[model samples]
Target: MSTAASTEACSTSRRMSIGMLYVDLGIVTRPQLFEALVECARTRCTLPAALASLGYL
Candidate 1:
C-alpha cells in the first residue's frame, strides 16, 4: 500500500482504539462512540473533537 494509505489506516485504527478505551472505562456507551465516529467521518475532524461535538467529551 502507499504510504498515505498506510498512515490513514494507522490513524483510523488509533482513533477507534481511543474510542473503545473510553467505552471500556464506562466513560461513554458504545452507541455514543458510534455516533461520534459517524460525526468524525462526516466532519473530517479528530475523534476527540467529534466526541466533544456530541457532548460525549
Candidate 2:
C-alpha cells in the first residue's frame, strides 16, 4: 500500500471506469469524444493542427 502503488491503482481504476462509460452508459459517443479532443488540439496547436482540422485529431 505504498503511495506510488496507490496512485497507479487509482489511475487504472479511472481508466476502466471511463471505458465502461463509453461502452455501457453512452455518456459520450466515440465520435464526440474524438471531436472534442480534436478541438482541444486545435485550440492548443502550433506545430501541427492538421489532424484536428482534417477530422483525424
Candidate 3:
C-alpha cells in the first residue's frame, strides 16, 4: 500500500477505537454512536464535540 493509504487506514482504525471506547464505557449505545458519527461527518467535528452537540456529553 502507499504511504497515504497506510496513514488513512491507521486514522480510520483510531477513530473506530474511540467510538468503541464510548460504547464500552456505557457513555453511548451502538445506535447512538452511529448517530454521533453521522453528526460528526455532517458538522466536520470531532467525536467528542459531536457528542457534546448532541447533548450526549
Q: Which candidate has the highest lDDT of all?
A: 1
Write candidate 1's Cα lDDT for 1-57 as tens digits.
Answer: 999899878888888999999999998999999999888878889998999988888
Q: Which regions of candidate 3 are displaced past 4 Å?
A: 1-12
Tell me the tens digit of each residue's lDDT in model 3 across 16-48. 789999999999998888898888767767888
TM-score winner among the candidates? 1
The TM-score of candidate 2 is 0.42
Better of 1 and 3 by TM-score: 1
Candidate 1 Cα errors over 4 Å, as ranges: none
lDDT agreement with native, every candidate: 0.90, 0.50, 0.83
Return the candidate ranking by TM-score, descending: 1, 3, 2
Per-residue lDDT tens digits for candidate 2, residues 6-53, read 975675465445544654665555665555444544464321242335
Model 2: how far is 52 from its true place, Å? 13
**Cα deviation of 33 in candidate 2 (Å)?**
15
Pitting candidate 1 against candidate 2, the one with the higher TM-score is 1
Better of 1 and 2 by lDDT: 1
Instruction: Kindly report which residue pairs in candidate 2 clash with one another.
Output: none
